[model samples]
Target: MASMNDHPGERAAADPVKLIGVRETPLSVDEVFRAVGDDAAGGTVLFVGTVRDHDGGSSVDRLGYSCHPSAEAELRRVAEKVAANHPVRALAAVHRVGDLEIGDLAVVVAVSCPHRAEAFAACRALIDDLKREVPIWKHQTFSDGTEEWVGAC
Candidate 1:
């Protein structure tokens, strides 16, 4: 009998994390979801962060996101944590910088696991940790002719 570590199936289950930075452009939700698609994995969870048109009753016209160099590094670290904590088959995360129109995707996260519960838990944890630990900031441009810089709130 093959040990867990020596088993081919177990070795193939490991998936490395991916992080990417890009200029603000149209994001394909399908692409992100496909990155985590695995035949052995029964569950896949995708999270998309969008630029809402309104914030706290104020109409938001657009948003500008900026990140410290350490931000992308931190995001990679978060993805690594998810892979270590769960049976993650594949993981990918990308964040857009520069100007973005309302309803644009700011970030996309996808995770696949052998079970639905683990997939949901890991997906939620990945996004929650990214929001709290990543150093990305957003400048909200309001329709009232004002702008405010805020953390990934």
Candidate 2:
């Protein structure tokens, strides 16, 4: 199988976790989950975020994600921070951008550690930090002809 492309602005130095990232195509949880698998890891956690049919009870027609040029850099920073706090064997995260239909996967993150709890915690932190800090915006169109854009200007 062909290798995944490197994340934009990712450093050359080797890291325990691979930083495969920010793209406009569909995301694959299986691909990312596999990247984090290691013989030494006793546990692995994967989190997948998908486009939902509704937002705050409003029916959604479609949604799209737009990422700033610096978004990948921010993702790497967040991932590194999470890695620093845990004994991660390997980790990988990918966030999809562009138009998406309901139920389409939006993001996938995986973390493998020596134990279950740490993997879970680190995976959670990695995702949370990425969402909070990354410069990615979500634009949604509702069935009622209204639209909303979330995240920074």
TM-score of each: 0.85, 0.88
Model 1 scores worst on lDDT over the 10 consecutive residues at 7-16
lDDT of 1: 0.80
**How far is 119's C-alpha from truth in model 2 (Å)?**
0.7
lDDT of each: 0.80, 0.84
Report the lDDT of model 2 for residue 83.
81
Instruction: Give lDDT tens digits, candidate 1, residues 24-102.
Output: 6677788888777777777888999998999989999888898887877888888898789877878878888888888
Tens-place lDDT digits, model 2, residues 1-153: 224763322222237668569998888877897898777778889999999999989999989999999988889888888887887878898999899999999999999887799889989999899889999999999999999998856
Per-residue error at 20 for model 2, in Å?
2.3
Model 2 is weakest, by summed lDDT over 10 consecutive residues, at: 5-14
Which residue segments of model 1 deviate by more than 4 Å? 1-12
